[model samples]
Target: MNDLLQTYTFLNQAMQSDSLLCLAQAVCWLDPLWRGYDEDFYHDPDGILSAALVVTRQLFPDLYVDAIDKLRQGATYATVDQLICEGISNTGIPLDNLEYLPYGIPLPAYGVELNDADFYTTHPEVIPILACFGISPEANPYHMTIPDCVYTAAEIIATDLAKRPEEQYQQVAWGLLWLTSATNNSICDWDAELMMEVEPLAWETNDLAFARVMIEEADEIMGDVLTGLYWLTSEPAVMQAMQDNIHRIYKAIQKKGKNNDAPNIRLKWVDLAICPE
Candidate 1:
């Protein structure tokens, strides 16, 4: 089996026994929070970060475990809050510095195309697992369905914030997006109804402080994500565009800050994408 499938199988077995919860909790506690309402984190960033953490520890335990321990020693809701403030406070780091080796989610060969059935047939065990979440796997070879199993497995090890009902729904929504991104070779129509659960939870929450912490922690933990997803946070234009979605939560619901973060993030993007390599 490919290393990616091997790791997934291991995690799958572990989840079946519910033995991985502690480790999942440990990562959630130590790493940044992915807010449910925030599409950037829940939809793509959180899953990327979680997959990076899970894979890094699985592949290089000493390096990742030690990092987690150290981060935990100093981690808190407040420290992470500061990190996001720092991210927003300054132009922030370049996207390249944030990039990491891409993780396993099989892609099609160059110039080749794959449909949903291709993924399901290749991984026969995935269909039923995903069905548990009401996300059916029925697309064709031209349209690959993201087996719900992946999201279900991911949620098993998701950040603590995902435990919140609103956040949990958002994470699921994000999980949908994450799967599509990983399968970049194919296109899937994302479910828009999922946002209904996310917006209200993100906006109605009594905990802006928690949301702030999730953002900051997401900033720090993702700074070194093994998956190349740091681009979501590092590239100014792309990151800003996504972050703008977060601020939209602010506008559509809270109507607070002036979305100053977007332009500043854009400046950071140019520096990363155009400046010296």
Candidate 2:
């Protein structure tokens, strides 16, 4: 465990510098036995490292596929995604078929494909950062919270905020911003629900920098959510789930402020029926 921890530490700092080299080294270090050990490892310390690798791969597609090819040949580079897929296929785990794994239904339709230029124009802000991760703006960022994408993204972000509470608020806040500004449908809601599960540590010892970033981002997102004020077209249950989550997030940020020096993050849900003119 200590060896794994140290390797992750080195990788984390390395990621701040040369991401590809760090990814290559981490993938090499996380031999198949350790990575493929079990499903639980994905949630443990290893989760953070695994997500870094996934994001790293996203940024460098050629490197990601090359690493995947290498790991597949080796016995130790098993992915939690592949394992879950295998269990669903081979074992009777009550999991959905691969096609329906992200949500228990078939994938939702994303209409009217656009070229990269047009797509980026549609989502000017989000595409650049996502592009750095190798996800074309054309690809859906909305999938970030789905089960298939969560282990690699949502949960990883959650874990990062938890262990490093000073940054938790900002992380969650930025996550919300990305969710609403960039994602389509219930995706942002999904990210918020996952993020709301983690409890932020007290403000005294936590890093104020991360918290500030989170607050700034959340404030921006709230503005957008309130201003756009569009009704969703997904199933009522899904939409309700998202609304309930929005309420929870609204309350959580309010509660955190009352309890600590955490930033006052407000979410204003507008009532369109009664417009003030």
Best by TM-score: 2
lDDT of each: 0.36, 0.39
Per-residue lDDT, model 1, residue 216, is 52
- lDDT by residue (208-240, candidate 1, tens digit) is 344344445444332323133332333345334
Worst 10 residues of 2 by lDDT: 105-114
The C-alpha RMSD of each candidate to the native structure, in angstroms, is: 27.4, 22.7
The C-alpha stretches of model 1 lying farther than 4 A from their native spots are: 1-142, 148-197, 200-206, 224-277
**Residue ranges of candidate 2 with Cα displaced over 4 Å:** 1-119, 138-147, 167-169, 176-277
Q: Write the per-residue lDDT of candidate 2 for residues 66-160, one digit (tens) a residue.
A: 44455555524345345434433332222232333322211111222222245456655544333322346445544332222212332333333
| Clash counts for the predictions, in order | 10, 7
Q: Candidate 1 versus the native: TM-score? A: 0.19
Q: How many angstroms is residue 153 displaced in model 1 relative to the true structure, after the best TM-score fit?
A: 6.6
